[model samples]
Target chain A: MIDAHAMLGDETYLRLDADELLRRMDAAGVDLAVARPMGAGMVVDHRAGNDLVLKAGPRIRGLATVNPWWGPKALDELARCRDLGAVGLFLDPARQGFFPTEPVATPVLARAAEYGWPVMMKTGAYVYADILALAEVARDFPGTTFVAGFGGFADQWFELPMAMRNAPNLMLDASMMWGAGIQQIVDRHGAGRVLFGSAEPRNRYAVVLKAIERRGLDESSRRAVLHDNAARVFKLEGGRP
Target chain B: MRIIDFHAHLDERWLHKPIPDASHMVAAMDRLGVAQTCVYTMMGFYAETPRNNDLLLERSQRHPDRLIPFVTVDPKEGPAAVDELERCLERPEFRGIKFHPWLQAFAPSMLEETMVAILKVAARTDTPVLFHDGTPPYSTTFQIADLARWVPEAKVFLGHAGLADYVDPAARLLRDVPNLYGCYCGSRPGDLVHLIETAGADKITFGSDFDPGSWELLAERLDNTIEAGLSPEDLEAVLWRNAERTLRPSSR
Candidate 1:
């Protein structure tokens, strides 16, 4: 299985390198994992983290973060990330402290859309990262595939369901979400819009994998969630069961 | 290895809708090889104490070998709460108490008179008290630690190991508070290994916090923990031994 969301490099709170990430993926039976620089890593030096992920080899897919505050420099970094084998883009509105619809973020997103790269945004938390704001961005960038992390969390319980129903361009990762919520999302949005994400080292891969398995999806739907959806959306190569 | 789940909930009143009943829970236990499960009712969160406790009692009685009931008390119900506790504790099947500070809208600090009264009874009864920890203000690690410190005699289990954010602080509290134990519910596999390393396996227990329809998730989480690099002895302690010792102190 491919884990749609994961992080690598040192953070203010934790340090997770490629070796540890690979170890966890192996333990969890994940064939490949997509990772991005964490909040602190992004703030300090996203390029360094992205470079490390690139060097971690093919089993690990890297998503580069471009700070919207960097303006033209942000697009430059996105290009660099693409050269470094990053499959997509990762944005954290809550950590980077910018709204998704801001002019600065719009250009970065638009650049991603121009490349047909999926943009994975941290959502479910309050303020700038809420699902409503994410929906707004998804609506504007219909061509771009937007993945919401944490599946909208506990606080946005009601809002996430509504957001999922309305926003077709928006997909959700099953990280830190309950089994029931994952089932509801599958029932409402179908398996194609749901991706398996572990948020590993922060959350357990088994927890999210189990949530998907517990949904009682038919074999095809299970494959769609476990790897196919993420492989298709992120355009990951060699991510087949 | 034998499995004893320290956290499982009953009642159809969950916000998620269509909660599982006792039969569903038993089927899950049978399938997963969960020899025993400590259960409480979700209804208790919304002040349905008597009705909820009655359902738990009936279910536990019906599936005496599989279901181990943990009587949930609102405490804010004052005398009624104490009476219910006395009533439940009188039964051999009721193993412990489950407190949801966030759900019940009470602080775990035990500053409230009713909380103190409940803790006192718990101490006298020598029953373990599982406090819902993780959320802030009302149910944070420090607040649960305050309750643990206040009632040193009562065996306190911090549910979720103070969640993802407060594992370090929870680890510190576990070292300082002799009565305080960490139960792995909704905790990451890495954190579970960290707790075992930092606080020792003796002070940690395993709990699925399993909702009615999420049995496969529970089994997978257990597998995750096993694969996360615990020794067989440590795995046994976490999966059942620690919980068995805590719930039945005589077993230790």
Candidate 2:
């Protein structure tokens, strides 16, 4: 199964290097983990962290984070990271301190669309990246797939079903969500729009995996969530790991 | 290892989500090696306390060995709350009480009089009270601690042990409040290990906070705690012994 949301390398909160990430993934029975740099890596030095993910090999899928405030430079890095075999782009409106729908972020989303890459946005608890903000951006970029991280959390959970129902381009990552919450999303938007993500090291991958497993989806929907949906969205090859 | 899940729920009405019934819960318990589970109906916290209590009682009676019923009482119901508590506690299957201040929309601290009233009944009947303790404002650790202080005669279990962010405060309260015990459900492995070390294994119990569909998540948390270096003796205490001692004092 592809973990659509994961992070590697040291951060302010937790330190999970690529090797340790792979080791933990093996322990948790996760085949491939899609990772990106978090916190300072996104706000301070994006390349150093993205480079670590890129160099870690195919078992780890890398998503480059670019500060949209960088304007043209951010757009250039978006293409450069994709050229370096990055699966998609990662944006953090909260950590980077920009509204997702701002003109500055527009260029980044436009560039990602141009690269044919899906954009995964951090969307829990942050005012700039809340469910409404994410919905607006997803509506703005029809061609780009926007994965909502943390399934919008409990505080914003009530708003998620409506946001998800309204935006076809928006998908939800099942990290840190309760079993009932995951089932609600699947029932509202179908299993194709839900992807399994483990905000690992901070949250247990096994917990999220179990949340997905408990949803009692049909075999086809379960496969779609655990692997097929991510593979189709991120264009992941080599089937299930 | 033999397991007794301290926290489990019957209804999904709180989230307006559907969950499996008591039969599915027993099936999960059998597969996961959980010998028994203490269950409360989610519908109780919403409203209709007596009805939900009866539902839980009936469900537990059906699977006496696999399920232990915990009645939910809204102290705000005043004298009616006392009646409900007395009625439910009369049953041999009803072992404890469950309170969700946050979901029930009452300030846990402001309900001290009501809490003490409920605790008075609990102490008299030898039933433990498990309060949903986490975050702040309504269900904060300090708020639950205050209730425990008011009714020192009653056995109090802090649900979720203040979750991840409030573990330190929960541990601090656990240190001073002799009657206040900790239930490790939906807590971080590191936090659980630290709590075990700080509060002593006798004061900590295992709780799954088992949502019908998430048994694997509950098992994973248990696995994490085992990996965090809980000793065999300590594991047995947290897994079942402590719960039995607190909820079923005569069982020993």
What's the distance in Å from true for residue B191, model 2? Answer: 6.3
TM-score of each: 0.86, 0.77
Q: Mark the 10 consecutive residues where model 2 chain B has the least summed lDDT.
A: B220-229
* Clash count per candidate: 0, 0
* Model 1 chain B: ten consecutive residues of lowest lDDT: B243-252
Q: Which candidate gets the maximum TM-score versus the true structure?
A: 1
Model 1 Cα shift for residue B85 (angstroms): 2.9
Q: State the iRMSD of every prediction, in order shown.
A: 3.7, 4.5
Query: What TM-score would you give candidate 1 relative to the actual structure?
Result: 0.86
Candidate 2 per-residue lDDT over residues A98-183, each given as its tens digit = 88878888888888888888888877654676778989989988988988877665356678889988889999887656667788
**Which pairs clash in model 1?**
none
The CA lDDT at B201 in model 2 is 86
